[model samples]
Target chain A: MPDATQSMEAIEQPAVIKRGSRFSGYLRAISAMVWKDLTAELRSRELLSAMLVFALLVILIFNFALELDIRTRETVTSGVLWVTFAFAGTLGLNRSMAVERDRGCLDGLLLVPVDRSALYFGKVLGNLIFMLIVEAIILPVYSLLYDVNLFHPGLMAVILLGSVGYVAVGTLLSTMAVQARTRDVLLPILLFPVVLPLLVAALKASNGFLQGFNMEEIWPWVYLLIAYDVIFIAVAFMVFDFVVEE
Target chain B: MTHSSDRRLTPCGVKMIETQRLVKTFGLKPVLRGIDFSVEYGEFVALVGPNGAGKTTFLRILATLSRPSMGEVRVAGHLLPAQATAVRRCLGVVTHQPLLYGDMTVDENLRFYGRMYGVRNLQQRIEDVLEMVGLMALRRDRVRQFSRGMQQRLSIGRAILHDPGILLFDEPYTGLDQEAAAMLDTLLRDVADRGRTVVMTSHDLTRVTDLADRVDILHKGEIAASVRRGEVDLAELPALYFSVTHA
Candidate 1:
């Protein structure tokens, strides 16, 4: 009974240091994951390079397939952007996670002290950064070719919302996909369906803005994108502890 | 939530790992049953058994990498399930998976885990770990460029960056060449020398005898047998295991 009591006490207060300062500790953990990912990307540059090139190729193909004459460009630009993002986001997400899982880095991360949710955030941030970087370049290139300015603040906001939602689901799905025998081919198939709502909102909202639709017209899509981002990120955080457990 | 020891305890000092009748299974299958185990502050213990034994499950449970069906598990004196995060903080685990982002560089991989573990002086810590794993020069190289052994070495670096009080190796030696494995052995010993505990799961009995302070044979989902080096009969393990497994 005494040992049992001790054991119970042990569980309740495992860390002698009450996480010191709660918010600081959580932020530190989250930032650390993000910083590591960013630095790693800075060094290799391969992940970003591949994502950019693939995104460009996707835009190129869409250009020919959709036959974007001047009149059609306005209607198609937003759709084209989401299509490129959805495709390119998968490239970044899959390679980002598969590399970790294949090289034993995931096991290494699991061994450490920070919360597992910190990891989920770190990867999501890392993937988002990469996706945004690719989009930054794609938007400029497309604007030069099609004469449509995608630099509008509202459109940028939409991109943020869509990217967050895209990555939330992507990160979770990638975790599972990488563990399967068919990792390389499985990521996109799993990701696309999961990110469909994000795709819908992004496509419609982006188009609404690009096509000169009013705030009232764009608000619903924007709201959906925001809600999607928040919901999945929360779900991902809750489920991450289970998925990453050995 | 129940005891003083379990409440806000210092992981800086303790026996490192302790479990009481740790029980676990996959679905209906019992992988570990009523297994009581513990390791001293700086001891190295080997978990040995044939394929499908509970070796991995035991490590997973101890590492808080997996949940047990029943029983108690503690690491660095942190009670499990309740203090799994605390246990994770003090314990470092390296499994067969590399777990690094291939899209990132070797430098980035080490740096990321260092931060995730919330180590202080992260840059210096990353440098120290990179040196420990002998990957400082290659840190800028993308993970895709690394060979299996190089990646495995980096995996070790990632696990130890936070200076865990307890370390776990689950088939960590798989795919590691002799040189890499030897380096890992030396690293493991050095880690233990720092008053940290090390628990490793492996199939190589001879190596376990060579390195471990004690050895436990896991058969089926239970601890088939456990003993110190001399007490483990070299010639009889196969037959002993067969009987334990059969029983």
Candidate 2:
């Protein structure tokens, strides 16, 4: 019984190294990883191009279906914006992690001497950047098309907070989905359900800001978004090492 | 370039890789029953085996890619499944996959690895590795545009870019033609001559016979036989291998 217990303990022991003495080095590795993904996308433009076109198409469909008159636009604007970001963000996350798995780049990254959390943060940051770029372009277009000013600072803050929460969970889930046999259909099924609460909070906060709600009225949703981002980012960092290990 | 002589040394002064009863299983199936293997520093050892002989599994364990079900595996004094990051610092691996980003150029690929290793003077080091693998002329070419041979050469550059103390190669010559194969042989010989601990898994018996100082037969998940290169004649290896395994 003692021998069996010892074996179980050994098997369950974590493989993560403590983040000490090389925090600066890990930071540099994280930046290098972010740069790697950006350059790869710059050359191919495959991931971004697909995501942008898909996002524009989804918005176009929404415009037609809702007969987006001024009253309809005002009421549905926040829902439209969050929906576009959520759907498109999933597309980008799926492709980014899939590229790493398909090209064997993930294994290459693992073989490096750097900490695995560095890799996780690098990926999260990269995916977040991609989501932001798409959101940035879409915001102006949505404003021009609907004749509604979408550049409110509060709205932008809500977008950033919501994107952080969405991407943190999406990156973790996408890495898992990419390894599955049915990755194409698997990501949304796995992601949308997990991010349901984040979507609710982001939508509520974004709408509150767009409608000129005071801080006292919107404080609860803001707190929820912040709490979601912090909790998931921490959880993702802790569990990401096992997800990528072979 | 000065070799592992300047690298950290264990108290005993001998750099070695040792495994005690390493075992790996996939669900109900046992791949590595029990593996007891060791290689000294500066020795170029080759692992040869049939298709399902578990050579890849064993090498993967040493590379810290796969964990052992139960055993003590140590590389250069760091125990694995626990001290993986420490072990990774001193190891280099070349797998069947090129592991290069296809859209990125050769320079971009090596630059990424150099940053990960936190290599000093990264630009100069990148230039040196490119020249070492004879990819200087094609440094700006996308990896997807290169042929199988060129990609393999660039991969060799990637593996050695970090100047690791221990190197692992898994069937590196799988897709190379005669000329490309010869180029790789020269590079491997140069690396081994520089006194790095080298372990390679290969099915090409004739080539490994010439390059490896020692060859071990991995059959049924364990080392079946280990012999020095000097003792075996190049022509009689096949018959000898069959005879020993059957016996």
Candidate 3:
């Protein structure tokens, strides 16, 4: 082994110098967390594959069950899409947190010296990305199946807002649930009730956008969605430390 | 090793870790009950106890992984649950679990933790850690494919990656083979020789005697007995352990 003083110096110098600015370190920690999740997901393809396959199955089941004409299809698109997203997003969130808990990686993350909220936001961003990727794939499939233009910018905005709100609350609750024995069933049970208001607003705004209603009509639900997203994100940011703590 | 009569402070007058009247309860049943413990800087104290004696619970509280229900706890001069972030920056912990992403390569796992700790010149640091753990050749391999011993070594590498002032190991040798345990002995000795304060909880009395400068027996959430290495006969440790725990 190297000399004791030399080893100590080698270990302490970097930690001391790296503590220069708190904000940059916090941001770096978050980005590192996000990058770790994405890299692992990319290699395993477990989380996304499960989420995407489940989402496609939900959409396929809905398409066969409701063989609606073009007019009717346009009206129900938002509802169908949101339901598929909600269930699939739940699967993604549960699996993401379960991976951490299973390998004791959650404690590893909690041990990081940065603000714990950084871990929360990092997980939210990662879940949001996964949810969006699934949605991105599902939208075109739904467009082809129903022959509806699901690519409207207004619709996209609603989807982003809804996803942010959903994932913000979902990530926090999933962390709480991951600690339990029945985490798989517990997350959706805990998440759905809490996310109902956000879902309602997203569904309404998405419907308005799909139906080509006036911006004035769509703006109310859009505003509600945005408000829900901001409120939940702030609430999650504040309570995440408590939620993850034992 | 000689016992330090001054239990409150190190030569530098700083207590590395200290807890007073520490209590932890799960719902109604208590795990830790009114425990008081302290370790001076650069001390290697092995906390030994039988199963359900709350050794893990006490170590977790000191590591800031769990909160004390009612007590004053401090590590490296910072209070816990309040100065937890500060405590974390200077603490290195290894539990039974590897706490690594199996899908990622060994290099990736260290890189991830190194970035999380904001270690400077991370590439060089990763190389040094891998070299020290004798896993330099396997750095590119996925961790899931590693043997338990390899994983444990990597876990130690991860814990010491940031070079914290204090280290906590809770049953780190739980699943390792004889060879692995021997390797860990070398690593632990090297870490202790570097003058880092270490508080490890273990069921292995033999290994405890070999690695720790002082041995503390925790029974029913309280410190039952403490002795320096020279104070206790090596062969009689098991008897002392059983008597204290059973009594």
Candidate number with greatest lDDT: 3
**Model 2, span A65-169: residue lDDT tens:** 887678668778999999999999988998898889865777888887778989989998999999999999999888877888888888899999999999999
* Interface DockQ of each model: 0.35, 0.30, 0.47
Tell me what fraction of the real C-alpha contacts between chains A and B each candidate also makes: 0.50, 0.44, 0.57
Give the lowest summed-lDDT range of ten residues in model 1 chain B. Answer: B1-10
Off by over 4 Å in 3: A1-17, B1-13
Candidate ranking under lDDT, highest first, comes to 3, 2, 1
List candidate 2 segments past 4 Å from native.
A1-20, B1-15, B244-247
TM-score of each: 0.82, 0.92, 0.95
| i-RMS of candidate 3 | 4.8
Compute the lDDT for candidate 2.
0.83
Tens digit of lDDT per residue, candidate 1, span B30-56? 778788887765567888888988788
Candidate that beats the other on lDDT, 1 or 2, i.e. the better one: 2
Q: Candidate 1 at residue A207, lDDT?
A: 91
Give the per-residue lDDT of model 3 (tens digit) for A1-246.
Answer: 234444444334435338568899889988998999999998899999999999999999999999898899988999999999999999999999988986699999989888999999999999999999999999999888878998899889999999999999999999999999888799999999999999999999999988889999989888888888888889988999998888
Residue-level lDDT tens digits of model 3 in B185-233: 8888777776678899999998888777788999887889887866767
Report lDDT (CA) for all predictions.
0.75, 0.83, 0.88
